[model samples]
Target: MSGWTWADVDVAVPRPGSGLPGVAMAGFRQRVRGDVEIAMVAHPSVTLFLDLSETGGIVREAGGTSRRGSFVAGLLPGRLRTGGQEGSGLQIRLSPAVASVVLGAAAELTGTVATLEEVWGRDAGRLEERLRDAPTWDERFTIATDVLARRLAVPSRVEPEVAQAWRRTQAARGRLRIDGLAEEVGWSRQRLWSRFRAQLGLTPKRAAQLVRFDHAAHLLAAGHPPAAVAGRSGYADQSHLHRQARAITGLTPAALATAPWLAIDTVAWLAAPRT
Candidate 1:
């Protein structure tokens, strides 16, 4: 039960100058002397891990399958199992608003983890090589930002109205009502639901719940009591929060308060969106 030392998580935070909306970059180099397991809690953004280690080997279990190499993980409903002792890479988070355009893929990848090779083909390998060759973390960040910008040049943009809906839902911290979201977007409830699911890979209700769960989880991790976390996060009551706790991370609020993964996030993704 050794704790992670600073050396275990050499981190490079995201560059504030990079103005790429919906994209954040962090550089991580890790070395493990023993086995470690991490719970990949549900999150609102799509995640991409670009392998930069000497060996392109790491195991990710999500949606009943294990994937290796640099990979793209869509928004998930619950934790995934990450079993690996060593690896170093750039982890990127993309809001669903623009993930499809940036990856040239679909948000339909929800609950699934697929290799970067599958998503970006040989280009993915080439990008990894470029990032690995960069002399410093700053250099890597610049390269990643440039690559994403290039990919976005010829983008597959989503509808502006749907994008607005997603942004509003996020701003509300998942406390949004679908009917109200539809009203704000000036679309019928049924239309909003179908279009949101079609473009974002998640139904509006599920997205709201996921966002709510994320806020509550972080509150618990920050040492807030479950009752307070529940009230502030829009849960009906403490009991409601307990149900979502099990649903999102398979742990009670008490257990999640000390989750190692969330602890790592403090330094590893310092600027990542929590709400």
Candidate 2:
């Protein structure tokens, strides 16, 4: 079981259809006969996991810190990992734009993985208990989305200008110039950088690059060549794409294209079919 990966598990992605805005939740539950360690590759969104395991809870290791309970992972997690025996949980992804409220502040979670208790306080346990007691996966999804919707209803969204800039960055797949975005948003470069980082837990440049890599990674997974992906993903060339792939995932572009972390996303998100 040391070779465990998302490909080996049965993932259930019951959709909420239209209720959840800017939030995605996927439920994963499976048992490995023996010990297993899984490498969780980085992604572009803030992630939260709700644990309901009857046995061992999931453990996560990132950077120099590690935790073994229900948790939230910030953007650009560098080589996070966890596994063993068997486990069950709900994984939720939140766009940084709406995360500021649903999560209290994305900046607080940036680049780090923390126990849900740390981020959600007393409410974390309550949520977990409620989810655990639920009779069905659909119920958990409903409970989880309802919780986030309640938080979002309280107001305190990101600035409209900053949100627009982020949307543009995603639309361009990180190819747009920082200064250009600042000009269009009417904020100085310095101001944009500060506010963006403070609210999203990532600088504009980093966010753009993350979005770019996400697009390219999926392209590669869909069987596109690196050279072609580089051309369309806004990189200078193939070599540039290779370096970014290594920097972000510690894997060459080819290997990252088939990486299991990304493969499962295809199944769970299912917005795009495999080519």
Candidate 3:
């Protein structure tokens, strides 16, 4: 076995035509000769991490709790960290809208980390076993996608209006007003606020902020200046962007620009075809 490095890790994604809407899957494997640690930033999606390693599997910590091996991380899992002596897994990112239907408890998962068994019970173990026995990353992706597709076939509990609101928010890059979303969705402000929070685990305003911050973080990672990123990301100004960045990631703009976590996005996410 060789030392672990992001560059040496094998990364795999599903075939382009096989994708489910609002869902993305990636498979990773590497030999670890020493300890490994990664600071994971918050993203807008609910994430499922399946650790397939037979020994020294990944351990995740957030919100004063720790989970080892496979787990589910909801949106805005603040200041999350993962460390271990082994690294091999399938990671699935599900949009909150789809997560509501698939996980069937997206609201309960908000801002927290829960074991896969806690979410899926015995099924979690079965899925992990199947993935571990797979001969290739491609096979694992196929298996994972098949399982997700089956789960998605169940009737969605999320209202169409709420899903539409989320779509509009993403399309606008969080620049639109919550009241406007309510109006577009044919619901009153109060109604929309309550329902959206109940289903997605965050208020509309916070969702917008997360989306905007995500945009700014990527731009910062892309070598843009903080002022330019803030303006481009719809922030009131650089100061506002700084505050939001600190609140979400606990890092200044300059420091965030070079974060190894965001840096990995270029290779593990952006480089892969969406599926």
Q: Each model's TM-score, in the order given?
A: 0.92, 0.91, 0.94
Please tell me which predicted candidate would have the highest lDDT against the true structure: 3
lDDT tens string, model 1, 159-206? Answer: 887888888877888998899999999999999999888888889999
**Model 3, C-alpha of 48: deviation from truth (Å):** 0.6
| Candidates by TM-score, descending order | 3, 1, 2
Residue 51 C-alpha lDDT in model 2: 79
lDDT of 3 by residue, 1-275 (tens): 23445775667777766777888888877654566777787878899999998973878878777667998989888789886664688888899988887788999999888898899999999999999999988888888888888998998878988889888888888899888899999999999999999989999999999888888899999999999998899998999999998999899999998876787787667532111
Cα TM-score of candidate 3: 0.94
lDDT winner between 2 and 3, please give it. Answer: 3
Q: Which prediction has more favorable TM-score, 1 or 2?
A: 1
Each prediction's whole-model lDDT (CA)? 0.79, 0.80, 0.84
Error of 3 at 243 (Å): 0.7
RMSD of each: 2.2, 3.0, 2.5
Displacement of residue 143 (Cα, Å) in model 3 is 0.7
